[model samples]
Target: MRGDVMGCSSQSTITNFSPQIAEAYAILRGIRFAMDAGLLPAEVEPDAKTIVYLIIADAPPLAEVGIVISDIIHICKHYNIWVLFTPRCANMVAHNLAKVMPAEDLFYLEEYPPYVESFVLDDKAM
Candidate 1:
């Protein structure tokens, strides 16, 4: 559901969107790219399901997220992955961490701040 996504160019890659939207787009794109590149096993293809739940602290311009979501859904349908949206509360620790932590720290759990445990557990639960 929630993830610390990094290394995405919001300006160019995610059109007319906020940084958070771009970040979400990057994860979906990354998944598709990984599958196409043989990084994800072929066994996880059509009929293999993955539940994708993305968490956001603030509501985005739904129109933009919709467009990307549609595309993501199409690809996911091909791979049998279900995509879901969830609202995240402001008190979520990952939100605070993203505002202050370095990119590398956000990527790996061992490197993240201790408070991120809640976020990680919620992500895994999804």
Candidate 2:
């Protein structure tokens, strides 16, 4: 979530990687986007627990994916950023957005999409 706001969402396509690697790549991309948008003190919630732990530990894993994780850690050092892990159920709005958005199409919205409004409200209430 971006501060106390919960409706914002962004998605991008990653090529030539496993699902786990792609997830890491997406988180990296999201962090970069937030930095570019001047969203300082950013808070990131990735559904992938392993990747979150890897980033938080600042310990690069073996292989090419470690390079991406290392870059994420490097960029995060410049800003006040916290990477946390949230269960998929708690990230339904984003899950839904990813499903509906076409592959290779990067979708971003400041407010919750109409289709996911209920989920957003439900999350807020909880």
Candidate 3:
């Protein structure tokens, strides 16, 4: 399963849980909701071959995330979704955007500040 870090804006998507894994799952749910609403790439159809782009950060308890990741893997496996791990640097675009916005106004791209594009485009792997 994919795993990654998000900026503070994604904090809302996380459930108010003490464990990192639980918090991380909340973000995953938010992402799934966005996909349902057509925010992410349409190529990742749920019924067809699905792909999850998990953004990961370098931090402690990577092993814990690995355990939680197994759960994600199981669910994705049931749905035929492919999980991809992306570095935090690559995911910084979303994280940076999340940092400056009001919670109510976080997810919309049209409302994002101009600087976020630099982070988004900076990922050479793309």
Query: Which candidate leads the pack in lDDT?
Result: 2
Per-residue CA lDDT of candidate 3, range 14-55, in tens? 345445565356445554644545444311212111123232
What's the count of clashing pairs in each model shown?
A: 1, 0, 4
Most accurate candidate by TM-score: 2
Each prediction's RMSD over C-alphas, in Å, is 9.5, 2.6, 9.1
TM-score of each: 0.37, 0.82, 0.45
Q: Model 1, 1-126: lDDT tens per residue?
A: 234422211112315757555655654654564464444322111111122332222222356565665566566556644434333452244344434534331233224455666765655556
lDDT of 1: 0.42
Off by over 4 Å in 1: 1-16, 41-62, 82-126
Candidate ordering by lDDT (highest first): 2, 3, 1
User: Candidate 2, residues 7-125: lDDT per residue as tens digits?
Assistant: 35556454678877787888887787777766777888878888889998989888787988998898888788888998888867766765675555443436655787776776676
Error of 2 at 102 (Å): 2.5
Q: After superposition, how far is residue 2 of candidate 3 from its true place, in Å?
A: 17
